[model samples]
Target: MSVTDTEATGRAPGGGAGPEPAVLTRRLRLVLVLLLTTQFMLAVDFAILNVALPVIGRGLGFPLAHLQWIGTSFALCAAGFTLLFGRVADLFGRRRLFLGGLVVLGVSSLVGGLAQSPGMLIVARVCQGLATAAVTPAALSLMTTSFPEGPLRRKALGLNGALMSSGFTTGAVLGGVLTDLLSWRWAFFINVPVALAVLVIAPRVIEESRPEKRPELDVPGAVSVTLGLLAVVFGLTQAGEQGWSSPGALLSLVAGVVLLVVFYFVERKVAAPLVPLGVLGKRSVAWGNVAGLFAFATFTSLVFPLTLYLQDVLGFSALVAGLSLGFLGLGTVTGGVTASRVIGRFGTRTTLLLGGSLQAVFTAALVCLGADRSWMWLMLFAGFAGGIGNMLAIVGFMVTATSGLADHEQGLATGLATMTQQVGITLGTPVMSAAATTAMTGSGAVAVLGGLKGAIGVNAALVLLGVLSSALFLRDDRPAALRASRRSGHGRSARRKGGGRFRPVA
Candidate 1:
């Protein structure tokens, strides 16, 4: 089947639904499993090496500073390639691209597992990042097409979001355990089996899907945007090591902005823009992504700093520190699972408002925590609040952004949403990290507390701003009949398979 036909039929590209009687359903289930597994692997891979940093540094004979590159390389490549791969998925075939990524990821993981030098490891990681760039959008697009709209899609998407969140914390814990018991290499080695399984099963279960009408690839636009994002993120990362006033940092920042401006003009004139200007014109898409960036930024910052505080201040082992992050994951899962139900009753807008407000409140509360204080309960509460807020914002944004688009535009929509989230995390992390560093410049417990306070305060303000933007700017004025239809569709699906089966199409 052609890519467009496969996409239209809700089957992933390159994979044919078996006999007509039960093929699509069976294949879809298989595809779903593979997609989720790949996502989990990608998410875990992003953070797994963090806990093993010390071991990796000592074994590899690298300085502590250079060790950060292991993570940064992956992040940079992943961010840079997201749109490129996303467009590829739209033009070629999502399933084909997704499978290809799985192959690259598997090979990279193997290479990383057996790396004899830091350079080799970094190269492997970059390849893995490229693979991730392909897998994420394809997985999301598959989800978009596989399930019909309403509660089933919402629950599925919510679960998918929760799993992705959990994978980060899980990676840290798993990394620590593996590094201590087996070897740091196990972190990468683990992906081999997972990737192999996904590759083997995806073809049987997932339907291939692509745009009915393929748009021209915006190569120039893609390159400019990628370079622009890289420059900005690199500049931010550099500011931590070198002073913010450093010439290199300033130049990178300026160049990034300039390239992005050029990209805007390119998009405006292109027949088939990499990112359709109309997508950005929609308030829902714009605000949703903006909110996502801040939310993810807050999340990344919280985990990193808190991990350090637990180890340095609380004198916890890596394992203990990792375990502490479970609270955040737990909260995210709880929030994600419950968001669909809440949205069903309260309306998407109201739920988003509640989520944003709650997140802001909790983030502000986190600012009160001290180095010496055991704020376990408070931390859990805050984590829970943040999780709920993050999930709500993501789901709301995704649903709202794609609501008006045709099937052909689904890949672009997913890509745009993913890009914004990535950009938010990329830009927000260094800024928050800088805030923490600035706060803790002096060498005292008081200094550390002050820094933590500043970091949390900044995050809280961002959350508040996100809430305000969503509340004021996002509008869903579908007629009551349409809303009722959505609810009915969602309710029927929910009843068919408990509370966890809804999938919102628009």
Candidate 2:
């Protein structure tokens, strides 16, 4: 049977819904491309403006302190609303939310590109974040639902992971190129075209999906969780830029923690909780998210200190410093593409162990860096190797995290994973930056070098902890869903049997 025909009929080659055919049809291939492209766009946007922050600030006449809002505004909104949007997609429709997010992204990017004032630009960024928050979970949930759990799904996710990592690497380069050649505004303008294109094509290619029976929206739970997340993320940003003891950081942290505590109680009492907290009890889901958090924390945090080593200590230009990251990017792409094969051969636990161990080793090796320019070769090698290991672990974490749930829970699963990832990314920079700052005891390149080494050491320590945790906790590779399906005789029956655990409220 043709792949497109199988997909169109919503059946396997043997006929009538069961496991998906273990082949990639042209139509399904197209869908994968479309979804993967969406993933790449989101990842790219995360880093695209980072390089252009200075240019954006000067163009909009932003005060030096306020310039951070360019990035923070987007991060805060995206991280805060991700969980809520993920569940919303499950209850409403993934395709609908995905398309809406694209429209919002395009419009916001256009406004950002045309902004005449810092406030206008910041507002646009906030909108852009909200758009991202919507699209990321929706697109990911769609990907999970579109491909059944098998090699095809593994391959798709590997590519998804690849695109995500590569997109970030590519964004830094593209941002630098666009900012230097055309304008910093091009970073925002660039997303407009991609968003517009995706908006036009996605409807034709993607299937619309939502739960069969919808539940009333969880308003109080959503508000509490969203506000809590926003406060925590804002506090982390503040703590990184200012000291942890700074009033802004301390107050935000305290408030966020309190709100989160309230959310926990609210979830327990609510008839229809936004997130079924029980999902966290699953070993794969809980441990997988922890793996994801550390993977991002280590990988993302390393860039900052490395940049300092390259530019401040070694006296490389900003462009050169950015370009130097190509080594790591190349490694990331290479790792992402090959991850599925490794997982398919070794299974998730082994893959996680291998990836984490390598990442920790390479991250620790970064201590070799100093004022000497000749050490660039070692740095490049370490970065490239580290990228491969990090992506492998990341893909494994994602695969593990989403493996056990019923269809209805996939959205929540992906949302949880994505949320942890954002949190990790947010936490890494500040923690590493603080470590670097604290370790600096002297002046000039020597002091900067000492700080960089200290940060790397701290990150290496964190990665080692991740490696240990995975070794201890990630004991199985078999998915709970597959086992349940085996016992029930079909995927649908398994879901039906298990669905009662999270029944919707009237």
TM-score of each: 0.88, 0.92
- Model 1: per-residue lDDT, tens digit, 136-217? 8878877776654556556667777777877888988999999999999999999998888777767766666775667778
The segments of candidate 1 whose C-alpha lies over 4 angstroms from its true place after superposition are 1-27, 477-506
Predicted structure 1: clash tally: 22
Worst 10 residues of 1 by lDDT: 15-24
Clashing pairs in 2: none
Off by over 4 Å in 2: 1-17, 478-506
Compared with the true structure, the alpha-carbon lDDT of candidate 1 equals 0.75
Candidate 2 per-residue lDDT, tens place, 1-506, comes to 22342474345544335756667776788888888988899889999998898888788789998888889999999999999999999999998999999999999999999999998999999999999899999998888888877677778888998888878778888999999999998998988888888888778877777877899888999999999999999999999989888999999989999999998888888888988779878899999999999999889878899988888999998789989998888888888899988988777887888999899999999998868898999899999999999989999998999986877788889888889988998999999999999999989999999988999999999998998998899885645755565677776654577783534349
lDDT of candidate 2 at residue 300, scale 0 to 100: 83
After TM-score superposition, what is the CA distance of residue 173 in candidate 1 from its true location, in Å?
A: 1.4
> How much lDDT does candidate 2 score?
0.87
Go through the candidates in order and give the clash count of each. Answer: 22, 0
